[model samples]
Target: MAPLALLVAAFLAYSVPPYLTFDPALSRVPAPPGFAAHYGFLVAHILFGTIAIVGVILQIWPWLRRTHPVVHRRVGRVYVFAGAIPSALMALVIAPFSSFGPAAAGLNVVAALLWLGSTIAGWRAIRQRRYADHRKWMVRSFAMAMNTLLSRVYAPLAFLGLGPSYPKLGELIPAASTLAGTMSMLTLLLLSQWWLDRKPKKPAIAR
Candidate 1:
């Protein structure tokens, strides 16, 4: 039930933005110069973000997680390939457009790269039968994957914290959201690694 709720929330969060006709904050900030040429890039972001959310749902659901490892692997491969790669590409293209300037751009770029690197490393670890390493890398990858959702979570919080009269509250929201989401993911990843490390190692049985 929790996972279903999270999935629904993620979908609505991603889907609602493009349809918004007017936003005071968005209107105040000039669109990034050359936004016209890169409209397709934004489309790519929406596409990959949607795919990643679907991938996560498949990954976390118990019945799907346990009952169909092969199918999961296949889906995961598509998810990584489609979601991670294009997402990273779109991130690069859009990073310069961030109203928060270079620092925010750097963080966005790093986050995207981390997402790609962790995913690839996780795949490699699985192929090498290093399940521990695979799990760790995957945890990191998922952390990066969750950034999309985290950004949304942070925006409202930032708005509330800074108050309505705060100068540039709109601009600050996206940047703060990214930072908060990244930190949250990092904390969760560290805790997951610690828990996994403490578990008893399974003996390697002959196939």
Candidate 2:
């Protein structure tokens, strides 16, 4: 299930139409600035972000990590150096285009800030040989990366649960989507951190 979910996530990240690339339904609202910056940053964000996601997902697999340490290290380099860093940085730029609303856009700014910090921290942890801390931060980073996926999931469910289509509450889609996305981010944070806590302590830092 984990692998399948990871695959789907990677697929979405790669194949999902560039929401900000055009003034379509998903990205209809123009928040101050227009589409050029939005499109550029979004392109950078999704491409590298998806690569990082796929790398991290494979890194999390115990079998691959255990049996093929070499592969893990190589992908880790790509994840941190090539994918995560650039993706998070680009997210910072495009976050303002969150069609949901200003609140959503603002929260996205916060998330991008945190995501960049965590990915960098995770990279530093590995360098310092604190494998445990590295893993913990990577989990956090991955969870935040699921922001897009979860929000999409929640919005449709919210629409259905409320009534049916846009006719029920069309204008409020932003609010509903924002609410759902925020909940998803928080839930993922708590659950991932809790999972870390359940693991047996191993000298805090590896050394």
Candidate 3:
């Protein structure tokens, strides 16, 4: 977890600075048409996404949860209310205007909804004192939040891998983008379920 967190932090360091500049020229991808405030929502999504990812790192740290439970709960509240929910709402707003095309836009919408729903479920689980359910749902929520990282990783790979083989760069971009986002989110979701369901090995019998 520590290593993975470090990797995500590194990626965030690399990807987040340009957005912070708030210059339209510095936009990572071309802003889609028909939206006057696309850049504003993009920045908001990035900002809240960063907070949510950081919250996941802190929340999942066993040492933090064991040693500083109060901190864990407080951070969880911030994550659900301030980080995950707002970021997802922004995603819903911006996804439809995705420059990547209709397929990517639809996928983004689904991902945002899943992220939002899982987060709300996690919050409700904790409030209801269903610790087991809370853990499952929160882990799932973290996986959804992590689409930010995986999307970046996959997008370039999708371009490079598919670009040379395809003749038309324009036509390929949207397909690659859709494929990348879908694979990234799906991979995380499957992994999270596996992590949640895995059985611990039993101890050896005493002599």
Candidate 4:
């Protein structure tokens, strides 16, 4: 059921963007010169988003997580390396130049940095065999990755609440999206950590 839900979410995320055109409000906004002129950014985003989805699948599957630890590790490395790096770069490029203004830009920067930091920390925790820490960090990474989901949810809400003509309303969308995504991710991470902490540790027999 969990895997099925994740898969559905992933498909919705990957498919939704192609159908939506850029917001008109976004067009009038000042961005760094030539930011939208290149197709490479779009390509990179698709590539990384695809890989991140695949990584999530592997992370959630018990058989893959347990039986092929090396493959899992490799995939995870690809996920963090590709997902966070490209996202950060994209954010850096877009944030300042955002049509939505500084609120959106600032949130983008924060989200990108948090995503990068969580993935790095998760990778480090796993390397040190700190399973508890790894779990927490991975939750953070997953939350960051799930920002796509949050963005989708918030955009509609913003549009509905602010209506079409509201000038500043669009600016709130990105900020709200980022905040919601981060908070959701942190909540899940903390719950998982609590659960892990409560589990009984196995006893080692004396020689």
- After aligning candidate 4 to the native by TM-score, how far in Å is the CA of 191 from where it should be? 7.4
Model 4 C-alpha lDDT per residue in residues 1-207, reported as the tens digit of each score: 385567656765665365245443333233345665423454455557666756765675678888988888888887878766676566555555555546556666776777778878998998899987898888777766666555655555655655544566556555554445445555555655576568576677631
TM-score of each: 0.74, 0.80, 0.94, 0.67
Estimate, for each residue in 12-124, the C-alpha lDDT of model 1 and write its tens digit.
56564652544424432345775764555666676676777677567656687689998888888877788776776787777678666666666777778888788889889
Superior candidate under lDDT, 2 versus 3: 3
Show the lowest summed lDDT stretch of 10 residues, model 4: 22-31
- Candidate ordering by lDDT (highest first): 3, 2, 1, 4
Clashing pairs in 2: none
In the range 152-172, model 2's lDDT, one tens digit per residue, is 667766656545434646456
- Steric clash count of candidate 2: 0
Against the true structure, candidate 3 has what lDDT? 0.90
Better of 3 and 4 by lDDT: 3
Best by lDDT: 3
Of the candidates shown, which would achieve the greatest TM-score relative to the real structure? 3
Q: Write the per-residue lDDT of candidate 3 for residues 90-111, one digit (tens) a residue.
A: 9999988889899999999999
Query: Which regions of candidate 1 fall more than 4 Å away from where they truly are?
Result: 8-31, 168-207
